[model samples]
Target chain A: MSATATIYLLTAAAVFGIGVYGLLQARQILRQLLAINLMGGATFLLLITLGGGADGPPDPVPQAMVLTGIVIAVSATAFALALLVKLQDATGSSDLDPPDAE
Target chain B: MIALAMDAIIAIGLVWLALRTVRGANVFSAIIMFIVFGLIMSLAWARLHAPDLALAEAAIGAGITGALLLVTWRRLQVLEGSVPQVGAETRSLWLTLPTGLAAALLIAGLGWVALSLPAEPATAGELAWQRLPEMGVSNPVTGVLLGFRAYDTLLEMGVLLAAWLGAQVVASEHRPGALPGPAHEEVPLVGALLSLVVPISLLVAVYLLQAGGSAPGGAFQGGAVLAAGGVLLCLTGRLEAADQASLIERVVLILGLAVFSGVGLVMLPLGEPMLAMPGVWAIYLIETALLLSIALTLVLLFAAAPGLRRRL
Candidate 1:
């Protein structure tokens, strides 16, 4: 891999790890949504970096897929946020764990 | 040397922002950091020579997503009557440690596999490039999206529509309104800003749609740009959430998928494969429809409303 590509790939790995940690550790539903998006971003970076080589044009297939993925991620996030709003309205808390359970 | 240095800075920034977004003490701060991360990722995409992805990341990833997150955060605060402090919750170390370790292992494995791949393994990009002429689009990404992989694009539109419908279902009782911006709409220069920005955004969106045939723009990018205009209008209180979708709004919402599939399916009886657009005119037609649908869907999603209306 080229030096630039190699550096980005490593960054993706680290970002992915952070996303996993956040997903596991976040208490609030909104925070978890942010983490999920972070993971999606990392995955896109990984896919693009992998499709890249040392020389010519980068792969268009992964590019197309990533574009689609970005759109899909936004859609899912919006729906999740809508759900979060409804949950807060119904239950009076944004945290997944009930107040009594904590 | 400077290019490498720039790459290093962006990569480090991305990691740092990702870390802060996940681990920040406050939810609002984390959301801000996430938006910054998205902008930096767009820079990285530009450096990687994918301008199409860069534009999409900027508009959709950072612009729309950030707006959505901030809006939701505000709503949550209003619901609770105060800002919520999102502190780290205590968890069993045993479970946390193992999960973190496993995630680390997965990352390491992915990195190894990515780096170890053959330098020039045949990829769909190569094939797409070779067959670009058949698709009648100069941009390979556009060609692949509308030509070879039309099915994915088709399903993607379906996904967007479904998401909007789902949001409506969840918030059935609460009718969302214009986002809270300046308390007074009569603030000096607000009109000037709207006039300048909204028209320019519309112009840029149409230009992008036309340019997608030969450049780094497309239906998705153009649509997002157009949606940004609608979003700006909403933020400024020029547009208000309506109790029901206007007839035109409903038509535009389904225009993309309907036209795309309608045209493609019509081809099947003509002895061509499904979704095989007949010519350049057909491509433009589909992209225009797609652009309208995408823009309307995104704006609706951000508004969290079934429809929009002009604010009196």
Candidate 2:
């Protein structure tokens, strides 16, 4: 692989790891959502890197897939936020855990 | 050499921003960092030679998502009567360490496999390129989306519609309406800005739709640009959510899926395969419908309403 691709692949790996950590460690549902999105971004980068390789025009198949994925991600995010708003309205807290748990 | 250096910097920035977005001092900061992450990732897409993706990432990933996040944060503040501090409560490290380590190992393994794959292996991408002429679209991505993988594109529209419906279901009894924004009637520039920006965005969206036949633009990108205009109007209080959708709004909302599946299924009695568009005309028809539907769907999602109306 080209050095550029290698560098990006490694970056993707690291970002994925960070996302995983965030998802595990976050207390707030919104924070977890952000982490999930981070993980999704990492996967997109990795997929495109794999498709593009070192030279020639980048592949369109993966590009189209990523485009679709981006739209889907936003849709899911918006729905999740809507759910989050309702959760906050009902429970008066953004955290997933109930107050009595502590 | 300089290009390599730029890539390295972007890679580092992405990793850093991802970390910060997760571990920032507060929820507000984390959200901001996430937006910044989206912006930088778009730059990375450009560097990776995917201009279509770059445009999508900047507009949808960063712009719309960031706006949604900020709005949610504001809502949380309103509910609690104060800005909630994220990351204030600490979790036990014992549970975190093993999970984090396992995830890191999993990613490392995936990366190793990705790197170990042979270079230039024949892929569906190559096949799509070979068959591009039959699709009648010069843009390979557009060809794959509308022609070769039309099923995926079709389902994606369903997903968008489903999401909007889901949002409407989950929306609280707040009577979704225009978000309280700076209604600066005193600023003469606001009117000038709207007059210029809205029309320009419309022009750009049309140009993108037309260009998709031969270039990097397409229905999704054009739709996003158009939605940005709607979002601008919402922010400036030119638009507001209504309790019920107007008849025109309801029809336009379903136009994409309706036109797409209508044309696709109509080919069945003629003995053509499902979703096999007849010609360039059919492709443009579906795409135009898709552009309108996508723009409306996204704007409604951002607005979090069953319907929208002009603010008088």
Index of the highest-lDDT prediction: 1
lDDT at B148 for candidate 1? 90
Candidate 2 lDDT by residue in tens digits, A1-102 = 688899888888888888988888888899999999999999999889888833577888988999999989998998898888888877777796767566
Query: In order, how many clashes per candidate?
Result: 0, 0
Residue B173 error for model 1, in Å? Answer: 1.2
Residue A6 CA displacement from its true place in model 2, Å: 0.7
Q: What is the lDDT of residue B73 in candidate 2?
A: 82
What do the candidate models score in CA lDDT, each in turn?
0.88, 0.86
The predictions' CA RMSDs to the true structure, in order, are 2.2, 2.1
lDDT of 1 by residue, B102-137 (tens): 877877877777667676664678899999999888
Q: Which runs of model 1 end up more than 4 angstroms from their true locations?
A: B82-106, B176-182
